[model samples]
Target: MLSAILLFGWDFAMRTYFPEDETPANMASREDAPSARADGAIDVGNGSAGIDAPQVVDVDTALASADRIIIDAPEILGSINPVGGRVDDIDLKTHRQTVEEDSGPIRLMSPAGTPGQHFAQFGWVGEGVALPGADTPWQVIAGDQLAQETPVTLGWDNGQGLSFALRFAIDEHYMLTVSQAVRNTGTGSVALRPYAFINRTSANASKSTWNVHSGPIAASGEGVNFDWDYDEVLEEGPVELGNGTDWVGFTDIYWLSALITQEGQGASGAFRSTGGETYRADLIYDPINVGAGQTVTRTTRLFAGAKESAVLSEYANQGVENFNLAIDWGWFRLIAWPMWQVLIFLFGLLGNFGLAIIGLTLIIRLLLFPIAQKQFHSMAQMRAVQPKMKALQERYKEDKPQLQQEMAKLYKEEKVNPLAGCLPIFIQIPIFFALYKVLLLAIEMRHEPFFGWLRDLSAPDPATILNLFGLLPFDPPGFLAIGVLAVLLGFTMWLQFKLNPAAMDPMQQQIFMIMPWVLMFVMAPFAAGLLLYWISNNVLTLAQQKYLYMRNPQLRMQMEKDREEKLRAAEREKADKAQE
Candidate 1:
């Protein structure tokens, strides 16, 4: 119930304050989005809202039939459309769609008219002059293909002596440099403002939730901003990103597509909602006056690729302000960043993500070993004194203050701190949250295999008991999908609890007894790696409990006595009930 409330609160907060969380079914085409108006005013939005939709076709047909430039780089592979000159078709070479070996590479961008139409285009927006639209057939005059060492230059002529060119260059990773230029050779001077916009439908975007932000994200001159959600953009209309806007774009859990304006250009932008369930990020520069035979050029970089941590950071260090912040680390970034580094180091050393996770657990356990030892010894001491404590409690049943005082004295005499066991749990809260964020956001962990039947550690355990681990024909509902690791987690936790001293309150003891199974059901749908960690921790705890028992014979003896007495009392009660 508390978790539900927190989630609701988070959603409410994002909707109320930042409100950019929305998506629609159809989108107004780029041709409909005239960058400027005839009244000598700049709108940077759709002129004729929701008109001239593209023909719906499969991505393969669209790419095969169109005049496009192939993108062949170290990490990226895609084709650039020539008609609109949009970098739309992109797929990661190394990342696959699923754990299956035959699964295809992960696609990052798709062309317009497709079900997942997402693309970035650079062109001119001017009044009283001809400009390139989505239908402008651009000719590649410089290079046949886009490679790390080779760049492609696309040119277009308005037939009125105005020549336009878009130079495209790519790095080894994901950044693409698009330089937009306009040359005036007609008899008269022309005023033109260069603009770039990323248009997409929300139909295929990742679900936006309270904690993990999806949709419009930005890095202003001040810092990285995640406040503008989709709903706000739809309700409030186009959001004007004032001057000092460094970069702006859409972000998913593992993907990002943004436009970074040139440094010191003071380039401004806005996120506009075209009539359909589509949106656009427009990066606009001031209008430049080009005299006859003169030219104007503006350079902007488009980043459309995976949000890899190391890659993002490297870009950030090279002057793309707060680029790494694209990977939402939450408020616990201080702890999470270091933890991520350690995890990466372990993965490098172990060569398997599952083994790396186990190694991380071992390291954490070793670090907290001393505290846990103290906790167990303290618990044992407290248990050894329980009989005396209970006797005093009964004597002072009507006087609670007196009971607490005597309890404190008894605890002091026994050298046991009542709160010792709680310290380790409190210490683990930050570590647990850090791991949760890291695993959920890291694309590198996706499709990583652990062991038998655990092909994807980032996903829930696929083998569930309800279906006999795939022996049966039916699949279980989420809550009932108890997997092998979950079962082991429950048993190991229950065993560890059974070794501990019994709670004085019957209700508390019953809760402790049931908690393991409850957690097992609750956690069955979470990532297998998280479950593996808990299971490993529980097993270590049981071993620690056993070792501690040997070191404290009195505590072990009392536990045995308590168990036998409880069993004998249960038998007597059963016999009495039978007689009655």
Candidate 2:
């Protein structure tokens, strides 16, 4: 057990310190890509990153130029590539590339020849069967537009009596249900394995930090495996984990493109490199034998869009196991999930994500209010017994354990819970961290407008003071990018610290005086919504402190007494220095 723990710790530390760089520093040449399959389809190993494909136009130009079927869903907008029936071109209609009015919709998946090459492909591989290849331009037989209300079907037929059709259906959100049906009209039994995979260029992926997983991610019956990132594929070539693969795909920080396997179907998934910084997440099922005139249909769900917490959770609730974890809520998800629900509810009520965050803070404060009361009461009791505690400490100065024991005895006798004052802070730490993770990971917080000059709460504050609130053209670096929210945060934190009694230790007092400003500088680069949350929390803390002080007169008196002593001690030290 000890060795396991130590091994895990060492692995974690290595990953944390030396996170794999998503950049293709050791990328193989495009010419070295795996050969095309016997069926003329891009080898499943060299999936759809299109390493050998020629360069094409820009994203918009590429989509406009392609002979494609339109995808006009509520939140997703793209085209289905008729060639190979690849769902290659996608843009999030609800999300934008930037906050600018003309920034345009976020380009989620672009054509293979384009820079943002990301897409999902579904087909079959079989022995003694003629399968549809990449060059096969599937004919649109049913629907004109692939919309939520209108489902589209693309079909192709091999000369050898094998008929293949891909029926595509979409919901109001990002889930695309792909039904791949193969009808064996021949005389003999046809054996083929149905498979789907998402392929993308690692160059376009969001940076995969050790904490927030990007690159290849998948979920099985056990749980989601966040271990294999693009770096592993870029370095190690092909990698496969334990089987029972439920879903497999590539995930960015805000976006994801996963192929969820059919329920109860035994499937194997793996990540592989197709050379030139391209990676693929393959979901392959066991081969099934279809006798003459038998049609085999496989349904694969493609999730390609923003990783909104609520949407992911909804999918998870509907039986997509661990789908909610796509957002990487981390260890604090117990608090984060409920907090996210409350935040969503508040947003619906308040009509602003930023306001909803403030509302959530208020709710957290309310939930911790009882603890706050107990904390103040404990502090008051401790204050009333301070002199007695000091006398006991002096008497047992040389006996450390005895001093702690006596202190516990004194607390019991005085009906004081000495540790109670710390309980609130301990509780708040996880809550605060949970909120931080929410702000960082939730796509719902992306591009949300807060108030004046505060657009895109997920981004750092734009009205940076160093640039004179965007009045001046001067752009400062990250260290100097103090914004209005950061200023308020520092000021509010200082006020909160000042509300407490002054520390007796000079160094500790100095640290308290400097800590707020230091934290302000450190936190300036965080999301504006997070800064807003901390500022709101600090303001509430000040109010709570005032009310608690009023409720505990003895505590207030103790605070005053401590302040006076600190002042007198400073003056006496100054006099001694002057005499010297």
Candidate 3:
């Protein structure tokens, strides 16, 4: 009952807050989709909102002054409106160096009913879809058409003389390509440092209120580690944004991310998106160094993909390393993962889960048959001696020690072992645990239904509904499935107890009566697939036990005869030895 309440509460909470998948027509119905400012930032909760300004760097001055650009925003887009300028102190040898983009923060304004927004920046992982700019500013002069305004010489030091050509180009995919051409300009060898930087505007108060979600990935090799983090964000607050560490998580949602860095490698960095109306960013960097007079170059890609799994998969294939599974609990994945592959292989040939479970159970029973047979025979021997044992106990009533000794002697004489009958249960426990694990985690069963009312193999059977006074939330289905199986279990226990008649132990009787209900309650939350398997096993066990009992009714007699033959052999051997 408590479990049912918890499940219901969880469902209620999800529906009340999070936006479900919506279509464009219904989007207007949802009054909750917040708007973004000319500057990137979301206004949430309050009517009025504001954020910090972008750090303006004069790229021409930066090149002339040998200064670096601090990439502050989590995401940025090339200015749709370009600015024209020239590099200071450097003559334009029919050349130019400018920082420009078609847009800055890649804003996603979808037509879907569930309004959504994202910014393009560096993904948590450094290798996938990435943002332009590192920590250093580039020489700039924005124009309608792509052109180089200045050429700067790059080297390890001022005089060492290994130089590279730095060129920028705007490509078809909203891409800004930065290329470097290496040249050995001096007698001495030199290596150059390559880096980039980015900055973004903060989100408005309403936008800040949007929730934030991220996915993480980590890789460790050769004592070096890298952590890739990516997720969705929606919240209500002053959004502090940057491509840096030390950011608080978005609220009201579950998150899964990976963090990778080499063990013992001290690397510290942060990606901050301080504030943006619809902030999203993906960053990629290949921190490769140019060898002495030997130039090596690298490139990165950026993407603006939807949060859907299939869309994410496409971007991921395009080098977005932090690909996350969109559906937290996928409809079919859980049932398909782990053992589902194996199950499918077998089911293809055998064609039934029921048959598979039975076959598996039969194999287990056969494996335990030796121990089980011994136990059953022992119980049978004990049952056969019950009459004599009862008589001895009554006759020796007041002589407790004698009664016990005689009972032990009688058990030995009859070759009975009390614990033998418990072997089946002992064997069944491990099989139960193993089968339960397989069913619980196997994704293949998620929506795979058994016939009638058991539509989802991975979920609890939902066909049962009790509307009267809210008694049981779900009524169990099919007498043969639940009721009949339970009855068979009870009958089997009763028969076993009858065959091994105990001496009126009140505690034992009470335990026997209470156990079945306890087991039923324990199994209530499990998937119907698992429950059905257990029920079938119980039914089969009952049938097998009945068959064994009827076919070998004098099992105890045979055991006693074997014991007598051994005793007679020992006596004859003793007499022969004496005569000799």
Candidate 4:
């Protein structure tokens, strides 16, 4: 862990400390665009930074006819990629950040940053009328525009060994497009292969960044991970723990790549992420003759939209690494996606939002019900045979060997399985972890509604103002609602502990009792969505156990008989084997 931290620290330091060249004198300041300040700075109205739509550039002008153009401007808004901020409430408050002109690479104002900050890119609009060309079959025309309905054409330079130009544009709906024109200007033909890269950095420059916190725990044999390659494939490495830079990467041609290769010359490709972010890079790298000054041009499109597998599949099929649902961090795919999908599916099936949560809880209970029943049945059998076992213990109290022998005989006769209970919970451990991750990362629950007072299921219940006595502790009247939810969580947890006493051993009980307080401290700042899931799950489990207990008082007795039958069958099988 220490070593991982050090490595991550070293990587961050290099990125943060690496000196960037000054902005070119000829280049127009981003603030020069309409609604920008004359001095090239963002105007904060009334001490608040209002979100301003990004400046759209003429595609033809930005990707003007040029030879070997290197667009190294640190902060070119539309030129950078797109991102969705915070998905997990226990983690960080998600929002976009303010743009600083000094930021070398265009910064994505995601969670932990300011709010409403965005860069337009490719978008999806279900099977309806899209933003004009959205549904239109895209070609290498790679035309760009500064505003709605205006089109601009871009060209490449002649005579240069390698000539490439990039154009930035936003369609009517503000989706981002970065079209490139790459050409091998030399006499000999060569492939102008394209690759995309991504990295993480702090937006605030004044403050020294100690570390960037990310993650819940990791599974065994897996290391702390992050996307290194723009491809978004999660590869395992050494366990990286602590506050520092962690990176993961994958090649584009791998699974989920949307590249359409044909006759060694591919044109117009799109890359889609399963996390709902997509980037399209078109290739026009056709062979050219130097003497005649011929060149090939390529253009690309990027979409920062939904992570629905179907959506991604659509883009991937178009020959770009689009629709990849792989979790860029940890075992999110293996754990998070399935869990959230289950919750979402349940919520949709149930008409009432709050009842949907109840339904989800019931489903989980039913799935685990068989295992829990088996465990409880075994425990009952063990307790039933205790009287006989106690007699043997007393009779052989002086003869230790005889007591042990008698105990074994009693176990065989009564047919009690001591490990039945332990096995069930153990089997559910992976599922528990998967659910935990889903609650942390699923965006489907974001701003979702759960009915009455809980207007937004994705957020915590807002405090309701009532003059309930100063007894609520916080002098503020609104705090009364917060206190109520906290109490409800506590009561439910306590009741669960009381009813399922066997579920807690000495250590487990201590941990359970202590964890709520710790959770309170942690959840106070978390999104209310997570708290709701936990509360609902607990309540549902409590109700299910109570129902089972009431419905079948002799359930344990039946289990004991079943155990005896199994034991007798095993003995008969052993005898048959010996005779053979």
**What are the Cα lDDT values of the candidates?**
0.83, 0.83, 0.39, 0.39
Worst 10 residues of 3 by lDDT: 81-90
Question: Residue-wise lDDT of candidate 1 within 1-580, one digit each (tens)?
Answer: 5544553465567667997645435544544656555665566555222245644567787689556799999989999988778888899888888899889888888877676778888888777667887767899989999999999999999888899999999999999999998888878888878888888777778878777889998888788888877788989988988777899999989899999988867677788787566788888887688888998789999998999999999999999999999999998899889888888999999898888888888888889989988887887777878779879988999999989999888888888788998999998888888887888889888899998999998899999999999999998755568899889888988997887889879989988898887788777788898888888878777787788789888878888888999999999999999999
Strongest candidate by TM-score: 1
| Tens-digit per-residue lDDT, 234-309, candidate 3 | 2332223332321111211121111212122222222333332222222223234344556555332222212233
**TM-score-best of 2 and 3:** 2
For every candidate in turn, the CA RMSD to the true structure comes to 4.7, 5.8, 18.1, 16.8
- Candidate scoring better on TM-score of 2 and 4: 2
- Per residue, candidate 4 scores C-alpha lDDT tens digits across 1-580 of 3433554465567667985544321111111111224663221111011212232233334223332112121111232211111110010112122122332331332211122112222211111111111112222234332333433333333334554444545443212344444555456544333322111111121121112112111111133222232222222322222221111122111111111222233322222221111111222222233232455443444333323343444544654332333333244356555555667677678754456656666677788888877776776676567668768877999999988878888888888776775876686566555554554444444445665556555455554234252334454422123434454666677776555533214578677666554444334333455566567767876776677666556654444555676699899999999999
**Candidate of highest lDDT:** 1
Residue range 481-559, candidate 2, lDDT tens digits: 8899999999999999898866546789988898888788778888999999999999998999999899888889899
TM-scores of all models? 0.89, 0.88, 0.43, 0.51
> What's the C-alpha lDDT at position 236 in model 4?
34
Superposition-based RMSD of candidate 4 using all C-alpha atoms, in angstroms: 16.8
Off by more than 4 A, model 3:
1-342, 387-414, 465-504, 555-580
Q: Rank the candidate models, highest TM-score first.
A: 1, 2, 4, 3
